[model samples]
Target: MLNCLIIDDEPLALQLLEDFVSKTPYLRLAGKFEEPLQALQVLKEQPIDLLFLDIRMPDISGIDFYRSLPYKPEVIFTTAYSEFAINGFELKAMDYLLKPISYEKFLTACNRVNDFLAARQLKEKKEKDYFFINVSHKMHKIFFDDILYLEGYKDYTKVHLSGSPNPLLILHNLKYFEDLLEDKEFIRIHRSYIVSLRKLNTISRKAVSIGNLQLPVSDNYRDGFFALIGEHAK
Candidate 1:
């Protein structure tokens, strides 16, 4: 079910939206607030999938309130005025509803939200199979399996691959890739290096070799590294 919140200063408008939300099978009314400030507080504390927001509020305008958030939820703007429609769409609002909204219009907006969410999930799933990185001002599509290891310098990382003689220099830290490839077949053996477990050719007490490149296994990560290899041996 999609979690929803309503923020409208008008008592009648809030009640109408509450009624519509209660009747919808896929939507759950998380909260209804007349004060945008209180709604903003609830937003910070909870995860809301959809927002039904009023444009003009006494404390803070809905447009400004939405912009203030670091992580924005899908928004359907509710306003009596038509002037703010352009601004609302510019901020990527899912839909806009005029005051005294009909049930038909509301349902259409909800359907759009559902479609948007479904498309987003599909895109994210496809991204998990492969990722793109910038190399020499061009985006390079690198499959996880193609990567042999990663080397980190001060503020950049060198992506070493299986057949490439030269590594791709990317302006990102090793820690970024470490977190990105966490559950994938990659393990960080040293502060400045992460090696693909599948590509690891040999292991020693103090180091591991991927292809002809010898990378150090620091004491900080040695125990976990040994534990991982031990599992593979079993």
Candidate 2:
């Protein structure tokens, strides 16, 4: 369900949008305001997912108000003016609703928001679960949590996993994995070793322990490793 907020100066326009939201099953009315200034107080206290906003208002324009906001929710700009449509889209407004908005058009915009959010959530879940890489000739699936450490030998790298007796050897070097896993929880501690920061057990001046393996922390990579682990640079 989407928590919706409406900001319109027109009393009749505000009432119509409220009625439209009431008819929709996915939309829950969080707050409704006749003035843009009145809605500012409610915005601070509420976690609004969607906004039905008026483009032209007495005190402030909706386009200016949205631009000033620190965190903007998905917005559907409601206005009679066709000229402001370009301005609304520039701010990444989800949809532009002209005055005399039909219930059918409102629903079509809501469905777009729902579909976009659903796809984003699915993508985030898959990213957290696994990352695939070339293992021999086939693309191998490896869970992020299963990783212990990676060891590089010349042009090849071996990925060590928890509960596994032998590591999976890949054609890629440690430098290749280091660049690929830059945003992942893995960090390079030595020239030959890249360990998962999540699977770390203990750390000392010159070494880090993941599972039973004691990987050396080279001087070149020591400062970066410690900084990433939230420790003062050694």
Q: Which candidate leads in lDDT?
A: 1
Tens-digit lDDT string for candidate 1 (14-58) = 999999999889999999999888877778888899999999999
Query: What is candidate 2's CA lDDT for residue 123?
Result: 72
What does the lDDT read for residue 2 in candidate 1? 88
- Candidate 1 regions exceeding 4 Å error are 130-234
Query: What's the lDDT for all of these models?
Result: 0.91, 0.89
* Candidate 2 segments exceeding 4 Å error: 129-144, 147-234
The root-mean-square deviation over C-alpha atoms between each candidate and the true structure, in angstroms, is: 11.8, 15.0
Over 103-132, each residue of candidate 2 has an lDDT whose tens digit, in order, gives 999999999988887788667755776878
RMSD of 1: 11.8
For model 1, what is the alpha-carbon lDDT of residue 180?
80
